[model samples]
Target: SSEVQMPMQSGRDYSLGEYFVEVKVGTPGQPFWLVADTGSEFTWFNCHHHKARNKTRTRHGHGHGHAHGHSHGHSNPCEGVFCPHKSLSFETVTCGSKKCRVDLSELFSLSFCPKPSDPCLYDISYADGSSAKGFFGTDTITVDPQNRKHGALTNLTIGCSKSMQNGVNFNQDTGGILGLGYGKDSFVDKAGRQYGAKFSYCLVDHLSHRDISSYLTLGPHHPAKLLGEIKRTELILFPPFYGVNVVGISIGGQMLKIPHHVWDFTAQGGTIIDSGTTLTGLRLQAYEPVLEALTKPLTKVVRVPGDDFGTLDFCFKSEGFDESVVPRFAFHFTGGARFEPPVKSYIIDVAPQVKCIGIMPIAGNSGASVIGNIMQQNHLWEFDFSQNHVAFAPSTCT
Candidate 1:
């Protein structure tokens, strides 16, 4: 079985809303910071206009490592480093290819293709009205091994994005997004095929200083085994997303009386584990009960007067407010998996001297609930795809 270990650094963006990871691509390995998104399936990066001359060099065991030699250094403020076309092993998929005709159409629109022999181009539109247009290609992606020896995953499918529209800006030190979703083309699925379908990650606190770091390990070298008393839950198989049966949520040991349909997977209403989302999102059916249970107890404390900030609903004044008043939340999943997130995970600091309940309510009744990255902070999450199970354990994540 293929096994690889890579260190993961987690930090808040300028808006303090998203988490991203640094990835090295191309031959000489140009490092690019990308959003680690479990909700998406396509890995893409911004491209530049300037081209570079290829010069072969050896770094890791792979001899294909080559650095780009260029003098007319025109830089892009958004992309930073352009795709080293000449130095990297790259190929564009044709529009008539099996991958483009079948798998690509599931996540992206293929209407832009002018000819069947042309490159398989795609346009991915997000719920936030942001979009990315690009063509599919395969290349090498290098990951810095913990032991200092260079490691790489070769011939990986990636998106060579040509343009971004609307809110899809790469200004926050982010080159693109690393898709870890369950789709066939996603990084997790592609790597899982060789790595025995197992992967794990330890997430640090969202509010933690930038100096702190974490780990995202693939295959058998999981870190959760060292943490002790692992709680296992069945990983509900939902294509293109990691779904789990979140039976109910309990606050301070009291189980909230939520409707059964709120947790029904057959109804297209269930919980998924997503790293891209910053806050937990529960369907309106479930969110109301959870919000009532959490807010009813906090009435004695001073409430901050503010309108809904972005997706957040419950905001409170942080001045002289004791966080101990907030209760611990435990998520009960199928197969006896119980996740008890620390108080800081749910009640989060959004601004200076202001904290808010980090859970958001999905407007519609048919949408799936999301267990966002914020709720998984300071914990080890192990995805055992081969065994169809996911294990979790509390951890410092450093």
Candidate 2:
């Protein structure tokens, strides 16, 4: 059964942006327009030939209208310092075959061949059902070598989708995503073999706004800082596509008794741990406690307009107020991995005048929260399918 993305399209809990995600199959010495999304996995890029329909780049019936019903426009390549062109760029494809050698005309990389007959294309699916089709090649991608506990990435697939669905509200400079899934099919798995089955990142904490942060570990570089022992619960772990079971949940140190079936990853729209969404979304029942608890701390604030969903907004104007005096959010996985996000990360403001209820209230209505990057800004996360558990290391987003 297809998982239900009730209320929202993604219905994710937390989201992270500026993620040190890497796409391995990228063209050497190349920079692409990519949006750091936590709502979905499978990082991709724009390919050379794409079929544009309705003045938009969509056809597979997997993206935009069919899957999530959201329209996405073409992405603009980032030309400023913010783009990671030089860092993750490479000289050519490591394919080693003359057949896969250079096509000077194709812009993404120097390894493109002018005339090719290979179906060297990738079909990338988004939570919204819109898909991107592109060519898949190999390249080395890197990140965060500035600090001691650094993060470096290599050998991942990045599709070059010619067209994409609209999600412009979120900075989408690239026409693709830096996928973060599991197993040999994933870039980390491919490059890890040569680079020592490992990668690391200093996850930033959006809450503290601290300089020091957590780490995203792969292989031996996982589960650091005595993150406590495993508390195994029931979680749905899908090796085929890469999805997880919710297992259970906790709030401010209290574990709520929800059905094991509801959290099943197999259940259509059951639950997904996305780092791209800005809020933690749950089904009608799932979102109640989180929303209720969060409301207690708002001593006095501003109320504002909202979308179709009863989206709430609040803000305060105090000289010295404590933002940390509230209930905590802890998502207890079957393996005892308590995915806890800072309240400040959830109690976020979308605009200068509005304070959006971070744990976005959806699912109950007709939308899913595509886990934005806001929730993930401060934690170290690892997609460990080999072990059947994604790892986490706490850190501050610098």
On TM-score, the candidate that comes out on top is 1
Predicted model with the maximum lDDT: 1
lDDT of 1 by residue, 1-398 (tens): 45676666665634444566667877766677677777787788776523223434332423222222222454433245546454357677778788888867886847556777778888987655678887887777776533354666777788877778856223424577788778765788767876668888888878766566777777777554345477899988687678889888998889988888888889878888988777798989788888888887788666765464666777887788776777778899987778988888888887888888889888876878989888988888888888998888888877
RMSD of 1: 5.2
**lDDT, candidate 2, 1-398, per-residue tens:** 11111001111112223443322233233443244443444555544432234554443542344323333534433332122222345222333344235431122333434445443443445543455544545445543233233334554444445555544223234435644444334544554554454443334544322223344444455333433332333323442233455556676777776655556544444565565444556666666766676667765544455552234434443234456666777776655566676665676645444556666545543332234556655555554434555555455323
Off-target runs (Cα >4 Å) in candidate 2 are: 1-28, 31-41, 47-125, 128-157, 168-172, 195-201, 206-219, 222-236, 239-247, 253-259, 266-270, 297-299, 308-325, 335-337, 362-372
Give me the displacement of residue 266 in model 1, in angstroms.
0.7
Model 1 steric clash total: 0
Q: What is the C-alpha local distance difference test score of candidate 1?
A: 0.74
